[model samples]
Structures are given as C-alpha cells and as structure tokens.
Target: MSILLKASDLKTPMSASDLFSRTGPLVFEVGFGDGRYLEHLASANPEWNLVGAEVSLGSVWRAYRRMNRSGIREVRLFKGNARFLVRDVFEEGSLDRVFVNFPDPWPRKKHLKNRLLQVPFFQILSSRLKPGGSLFLTTDHPEYFEFSVQQGQESLCFDVIQGPPPPATLETKYARKWRDQQKPIFHAEFRCHTVIPSAPRPISSIEMQHATLKGSLENVGPFTKQVRRFEGGHAFVMEAYRELDSQGLLFKVISEEQDFRQELLIQAWPKKDGVYVSLQPFGDPMTTKGVREAVLAVTDWLVSQGLELDQTWV
Candidate 1:
C-alpha cells in the first residue's frame, strides 16, 4: 500500500483491515505538521496503524519523505481536513487513540469559530473512539487547551484530565521552538466516558453526472457568474472560458458543504446531437451533492440562455 492516501482512497465506512498490514491499534494524528510525532508513534509501535492527516501539501510531502527514509510501513497519511476522516470515514469505535500536538490556537477572538476541538467535533470524536480510548492534546497555548477541555466537557462524553506531555510531542518542531523560549507546554487527555451515537454525515459520496443539452453554442447567450444554493451547501460558478479551437466552454466552480470545499471545472463541448456538459476531473474532487449541484447550476444557466435541457443525470 502507498504511504500517501487521497480522499477517494477512503471508503464511506473505513475499515482497519484494509488500511494497515497489521493492526494492533489505530492511532490518528491531526495536522501532523512536520510529522516528527507521527514518526515517533509509528517507530515505537510497529504493530499499530498510524494514520495522519495534514492540510499543508508541503508538510504532507515532508512527512512522506521522512517516513520513506525510516522505512515505515504501518502508516497511512492523508492530505485534507482530518475532520472528514473522523466524521465521514472511520467506523464507530474504530479509533484507539487520537493526538493533537501544538495545533493552531486561532487565538484572536474573531477567529475563535475557526478553532478545531469544538463541542460538535468532540461529540463526533467521542463516537469514533473505542471505549477507554483517549484524545491526547499538547500545546503551548494555555487558553486553547482550556477551551478544548471545556468543549469536551460540554459534549458530556469525556473526562478531561491533566497529564504529562508525551515524549514524542516534546521533540516536535513546534515543541522545540517553544522549548527554546522556555514556554510552558500544557498536556491533557480527554478520556472517553460515554460513546455517543455517530452524528449524521453532512457530506457523502456520489457519482458525478453530466447533462445533455440539445442546443448549439451559437444559440447560447453570454455566460455570467452564477450562484446556486442547495439543501446543505452552495456552489458558485466563478468564471467561464471559451475554447477557441472547438468552441467549447469551461466554467470554474467553487462549492462548500460543511467544512469541505472543492474547486473544479465543468466543460461544455459540442457533441453529435447536442452540447455535453460534465465535470472535468482535474482536481480529483470527491463527488458530493455540492459538486453535483455545481454541474446542475451550470446546466441551468445554459438553459436560461435558451439552450434546450434535453436530459440531466446530476
């Protein structure tokens, strides 16, 4: 199995057997910055499956190289919001331990909403953790640590306990930076006391579909930026480009559903009978309702421009 995993590599309800060569326990690290702590976990527990999520592409590549150099095999890494894995992928009671090492505090009052470890997330995390499983958090920011504990308490699923920082956590890049300045690091463990029911999944897997519009580009009117809102999300058609060679049109679209956001392109090209409107697979986006609605919105715009809506599968 490859060390790097994409969003599509994950199943709706992920299984441990499919992820690791040998699974003694499943450990997940959120925003595994430079991956030093993740490497530590994998090296110390070769029998365990160490899964990590990182949003930065540079960090993902750096971590991938570090793991390769160490010849680590019982690990898998994902480059996206870790919440998606916890909320939509992992099966209930699948996680043994979770780690959050020096996560961004989002200290400003206005940006507090951007902070992770909120009450809803704590509840979701509680559902995924096995009985007695705990989420270990180590950070230099005292306020964030206290906020997380209070949020976990509000969830009513965990017993927050002050604890010593893990050895691996102290050696991370951020940890070393803080240590050089003699800043105090706080550690806590939120042990699961009661496993709540899994929260409803806001995003789901769907097959991307195309629409067959019975019209010609010559008959279509000028394109304009459009926005469409659906049940759980919204999409924006940001720009349109006309292909000079084939007279095709491509639209750049952005969609947001919950915490997940996707930017993709939809192409409208002439066919034998009509114009074929479909999503271009340039970004490897997970086909979700928002993305499907993006295509629908584009097709609807063409219809408003006088194109005949022959059929649509979105």
Candidate 2:
C-alpha cells in the first residue's frame, strides 16, 4: 500500500521516533519533483527513513505509484508546504539530512520574497537539522543558487560548501533536462554548525473544537455572500446553506492572511439562551487567526441583522 500521509495523519510538532516507530537516521526531500532522487535514496539506503514533501498532487501520485511498485516501505510522502511541515511537524534536531532540488526560482525581482531559500527558511532548516546534519541543494538557476548561499552564510548556522551536484540528484528530470541543454548546474551543501531555534507555530492544530457566541438567532436572514476586510487579513462568506431539517445555518467561510489560508464551515445554531456559533467539526479545518476572524465576521454579520453580540468565546 502507498505510504502517502495526509495532514491529519500527523500530530502537530510530530517526532521522528513517533513517525517511524523507531529511532534511526531520518532524511527529508523538499520539492521531490517526479520522485526520482527520493526513490533512489530510499532504495539505496534501507537503514535510513525517508520522507518526501511535494505540493503537486500529480507528482505525489506518480511518486506514490513508483514507490509502491518498488516495495519501498521506508518512504513516506507529505503533500503540502515544506516550510510548514518542517516547522510544525518535525521535532528539533531530528533530521539527519535534507535535500531540495530544482525549486522554483521565481526569477522576477518582485517575487524574490516568494523564493523558498530565504534567511527565515534557513533558520528553520537549521533548527530541524541534527547536530551534524546538512542540507544539499541543486538548481540550474544561478541567481537563486547565489542568493541561497548568501542567505545561508548570513544565518551563521551553516557553513556553505560549493560543489558539483551529487550523482543521485542529477538523476532527477530537471537535472537531466538542464544538463542536456548544457546549462550550468549549481550545487551547495550547507552543513549545520549551530542550532537556531524556530519560532512557535501560529496554528497549533487543524481541528477546531468549538466557539460560543451570546446572541439571539432570530432575524438572521439576508445571509448573502460577502467579503470583509480586517486589519491583517480578510474573510469571505463563500456561501450559506440551510439545514435540511431546519435546525441551523451553515456558512462556508474562506479566510486569507499573508501566510495562512483555510476554508471553514461556521454553524449558527439556536441555543437555549443565545445563538451558538462554532466551527463545524466535519470540515477538519485548522484554527488560525484568519479562521477566528472568520467566526467573528459571521457573528458581526448576525449582529448587524438585529441580533446583539453580548459575548463571544472563540
């Protein structure tokens, strides 16, 4: 069976020992495009546990099929942001090595901030690495490579070593394509020399228990779709759904912030004393600052419709 892991499969700030059920060397590959290198590493080193993180579902599926066919039981896949996975899931000083190959360069000057190898990323990577752990990166983009090197040096947690791309990493599709075109490939090995503590995660868990609101449920009509802009982010009521049994109303809320986003369902049910507004348990959405804002947005909308907001516990 495929060892592809969903977000819910992991606990916030998970440990490597818990994940593999044993303690051994652990390696991670960020942006495992096509999974060639990851597969090679897994097959080549059966003693070490391998974890692959990729955002593309198509690439994830392809990698999953390849690993399944090869009976590679040591490999696991995560489909989401690598930063979040590293910062929120992996324990400190847990990773033996990390590989990032051919990440998007985001060549435009205006989009440089979007690049993955910034100073903040280097700090987080350093904290996640073991005492002697190293990060191996290969890219055909010279500017990005140089930028990454500079960032690593500035972080003071790693000693950058410039070298030729590793043989296994060159097996990737992007590496082969770039090599075929005679483009110069840049490689860097950032050896972690010190530990850098990462900041606490903003959202601790994806599952929200409940929220209570003290307000009347009457006259809660005209729940049309609308968007509200707040100080740091925005919330949008994507749609409203009436319960088939006429018990309550479900509002689909989309919350957006600079670094976080989630689509949650907020339920407005009538309680004995007031309306109970809470996140629907079935959506399995992460409780974030934006999500809390979304709940407040719904409550404020209800108040605007004639209900008075006496209290809120979200």
Candidate 3:
C-alpha cells in the first residue's frame, strides 16, 4: 500500500522537500477528485514531487489504492480541509504549481462564501507559491469560473492568464463528464507576481500534561453523550472506551470553532498519584482553543463523576 500522511505526522509549516525526501519542483492539487489527474501528473513528471489534499475519506482511500497499484511513490495524500493544509501545514513559497479542477461552486446564493475561489483564498494561495509559481484552475460551472477570475484580479497578487486546461487535468472524471455534456471548461492561470504576506492561522500547540486526582477510581468508567461550551468554541464527547487490562479510558471527542473542527481523542489513565488526563497523542490534532477546551471538558467530566481533583496541568 502507498504511504498515507495523517494529520499527526505533519509539523505546522512543514518542508515539502523534506517530506518527499528529495528536492524538486513541488506541485499541489487542492481537490484531487478520483485521483486520476494526480496519478497522471506523478507518472508524467518523475522529477516533481506531488501532494494532494482531499476531504473525503473514501476518495482518499481509493486514490491511495490506485497510487499503490501504479507504484507511484512521489505523491502524498492529506485527508482534511485543503485550506487548513495549505494555510497551516505548507511553508511559505514552498510550492511551484497548484491545481484545482472542478471545485464545488456552492451555487446557492447563500452558500457563495463557501466557494474556494474567493478573494481571501486567492491571497492566501498566492503567498504559498514561489515567485512566478502559478495556480491553475479549471471548472465547468460558468458562474464559479467568472467568480474565480474576478477574485483573482481583485486580489492584486496574481496576474490572471486565461488559458486551456492542462492535458492531465482533462483526464479527471469531472472534466470528462463536462466534456461529454458539451459544457465548455473554463481555465485560468493565476501567476504570482507579488508576494502576499501569510496570514496568521488560528492554531496553537500545548504541552500535554498529566493530572492527579484522589477518589474512587472504579466509578470512573465510560461516559455517555456530553457537551461543554467554552469561550471560543464547544466540545462534545461522543463515546468512551476502556483499554483492556488497563485503567485507561479513551474519549472520542468532537471539537468545533466557528471556522474549524476536528475529531480528537482524550485519554484518562491511572497514575500512582491518581488519574492522569490529557489529550491523546494518537490523533495528531492541532492545538486550538477548542482542543484545549476538549481536554478541560474531559477533566471536568471526570470530576463530575466523583473523582477528587488533586492537581491538574492539562
């Protein structure tokens, strides 16, 4: 199977060359639907390292299987929001090229802000590209196409160049479908002419610390559905699991801020002093306010379950 990168494996603002283990031109595909174009690019350019960000787990799995079968080792797949990966994970000016084929138009009037080709997105994307690097976009939706063009022009960071879609891009399922339906595909290249300052990402990391409590440990079992609200966001504990043969309990949690959300795991295990609680390392979650609230939520839940609080460094 092809190696897949989990969010936990990435450092904030990672080095693309180091991740690929080679220095070469780096390319990113925002929504590599069906993975056809991604595979084609990897095969066509052996000297280029490719990275893809996809939100759908099913799509990611299918793409991974295809890459493994094709023996394509120069590609990495990130399963999450492309914006998060681009804005938080990749270093500034680390990319040579970026591709977006048939992204969701969010056609409804109320949903326009959800479209990917907005002005803010253009500004952020431009900051990630090296000098002269370009963003290639192809979409079948006429309205989204025009919208993207207007946003690119307004951003002032890219010199928009109307162009034909790249050959590999045409291999994507959406591109072929649109072609068969006689829909004219709109293509535009946004060449970075000026450097745009990187925006600060609303993410932070915290040192995971253990807590001690003195109480009846036997009552500290699995918890049911519970929710907690914090200053910036809220957290919900969906379920809890007990580690066999150990006094460790793992809580599956969902934490959400206005613009970001993550599924995390928090653990409460027995220590010599008492019960230790902290965010689990397995999920590789970015430390955000919501995440901190999640840790606190779990700790507070334990206290509610009759566990006496001794000392906490969560």
Clashes of each: 0, 1, 0
Task: Please tell me which predicted candidate would have the highest lDDT against the true structure.
Answer: 1
Give the candidate order by descending lDDT: 1, 3, 2
Residue 24, model 1, lDDT: 80
List candidate 2 stretches off by more than 4 Å.
Answer: 199-202, 205-208, 211-236, 243-247, 255-261, 270-275, 286-293, 310-313
Q: Which digits, one per residue and each the tens of the lDDT, describe model 2 over residues 1-314?
A: 23787544666677776678656799999999778888899778888888888888899999888888888888789777787777777888889999999999999999998898888888988888889899999999998999999999998899999999888887798989998999999999999998888843645443443455566555567677778787767999888777887567788998866444557888888888777777775545556666677788888777778776766665
Best by TM-score: 1
lDDT of 2 at 90: 82
Displacement of residue 293 (Cα, Å) in model 2 is 4.2
Candidate 3 has what TM-score? 0.88
Clash number for model 3?
Answer: 0
Q: Name model 3 segments beyond 4 Å from true.
A: 199-203, 217-224, 227-234, 242-248, 256-261, 271-273, 281-291
Show pairs that collide, candidate 2: 206-286
The digit string of per-residue lDDT tens for model 1 on 1-314 reads 78898655667678787787665899999999888998998888877898999889999999999999999878899888888789877788889999999999999999998888999899998889999999999999999998998999999999999988978899999999999999999999999998889754745677857999988877565667899999877899999888888989999999877666678899999999999999888877778887789889999899898889999888
Poorest 10 consecutive residues of model 3 by lDDT? 199-208
Query: Candidate 3: lDDT over CA atoms?
Result: 0.82
- lDDT accuracy of residue 65 in candidate 3: 90
